[model samples]
Target: MKKLIIVFGIIALTLVSCKNGDENNADKKTAVRKKVPVRKEPKNVSYTLESAKEWLKKNKSKQNLKISLAVNRTDKENFAKMDSVIIPTDLSGDIVFYLPFPLQVDFLQNVDKIILFSYPTQAFAVYENGILIRTGPTNMGKAKDPTPTGLFFTNWKAEETTSTFNDEWELKWNFNIENKKGVGFHQYELPGYPASHSCMRLQEKDAKFLYEWADQWVLADDENVKFKGTPVVVFGSYDFDAPKPWLQLIKNPKALAIPESEIKEIIMPYLSTILKEQEKRKKT
Candidate 1:
């Protein structure tokens, strides 16, 4: 009996030692540590002030872009369109048009004096010897500040401009006017009829040759013709004699001679003031 009790006591002692070790292991598991994550750094972009300025300068430029158009001012709806009729200088010498209030084509009839139509309306007129040659729709400034309605003379022209005006400045044939800094005629790209600040606008090609036309007569170096205080009559009404002036024949493919009754009349060798200048040049 003694031996059996001793054995039971040993076994109980062994069980207690195992239970203590198990509790110690449970505590260690509950106190386990955690790992931390690593972070990455960001990089910065750099540029020079001069380089930035150069980029902006290239992007924001206030330049006057050039454009060409074909227009007919007689029809308010057809002011600046290129549909059917185009009077090219090479074809008939009337392809280009100078839009002074309401003109659509820049024409070179090779005539003596040129006539502008559509004084203040979209539709203007062009005639040669009492015959209606062409018409189109155009836009002019407000009537309060309208383009004059009269027989005006071609006086000036410019192919390119360096001005900052909100207009197509580099123009062809800036015609004679009472005002120069404020008024004249040239080629313009109008958004619609009556789309000018104060000058006459026309198509680029028309304006190009028109400038040459006016320069032939008025520019001092080539000043061969003169019409001081030239009559710019905008009757707005078409008359046989008034509409078909003799000067318009310069465009005739067959070129009918200028009869005395029409132009270069009676004064035999009747030199205009410009004639004296020509004679002096010949003697030189």
Candidate 2:
């Protein structure tokens, strides 16, 4: 009986040892296999103008632009070629894309109003966020008599305007809609800044269209008279003739969203013309 019990215990010990060895070997095999691979980032992504909505979804801030303003400057072509050499290189300055007359830009999310400015022109182009959908060209002042460039707040303007000094037919430069302070933008004949009595003009159709563009929907509160929110954008270059204190703030401003090189490139082409004009003065 004692021999039989001892043999049974020996058999159980042998089986347990063999089972443990088999489990250990399986664990080692699984641990030696390769790990899953990681994916890489995409190189570039292309987008279209039609994707404006999709653009806002991805790029919510001004810092993140989905599309760039395609500027083809023909006006300054004889003056300089800045488009090729200026951008994509100097990433730190305000880049002014040269646009033809009536250039259109995308109004991003929450952008209800667009303030437009043209060099030597007195009138400002104002467009509603969504309703108008296009920029309505307005008048500046008159021929030789131009709108002064500088920091300003547009609360209201005056009335009685003409598109042409020769033509009798004229509409409200400030739309004659309401709250006109006797000096506002409206449709007057376009020949030059000397065409008006200090009031900026626009195409009657453009002025009428813009007056109702974002009316009531926009905050008419004036800004940058002494504060900022007034995005004073000038499309043309100025002579070192130097601007008023307010105008100085706009051109040589300290606050900027782009690179210094870009700022240099932007004005460099235009200023070269001024510099040339000045050099001639020195020679004289």
Local distance difference test scores for all models: 0.31, 0.30
RMSD of each predicted structure: 45.1, 34.0
Best by TM-score: 1
* Worst window of 10 by summed lDDT in candidate 1: 13-22
CA lDDT, candidate 1, residue 67: 8
User: How does model 1 score by TM-score?
Assistant: 0.37
Looking at model 2, residue 19 earns an lDDT score of: 8
Q: Number of clashing residue pairs in every model?
A: 45, 33
Compared with the true structure, what per-residue lDDT tens digits does model 2 show for residues 1-284? 00001111122111000000111122221222222223222232222122333433544444233112221111122113221211121222222211122222222112234354554322244433212133322334333444444323333222443333234444463422112122345554553223444344555555566555522212223321121121223344323243211122133332212232342333333332322332333353
Candidate 2 residue spans exceeding 4 A from truth: 1-110, 120-132, 142-144, 151-153, 157-183, 192-194, 214-284
TM-score, one value per model: 0.37, 0.32
Task: Report how far off residue 276 is in candidate 1 (Å).
Answer: 16
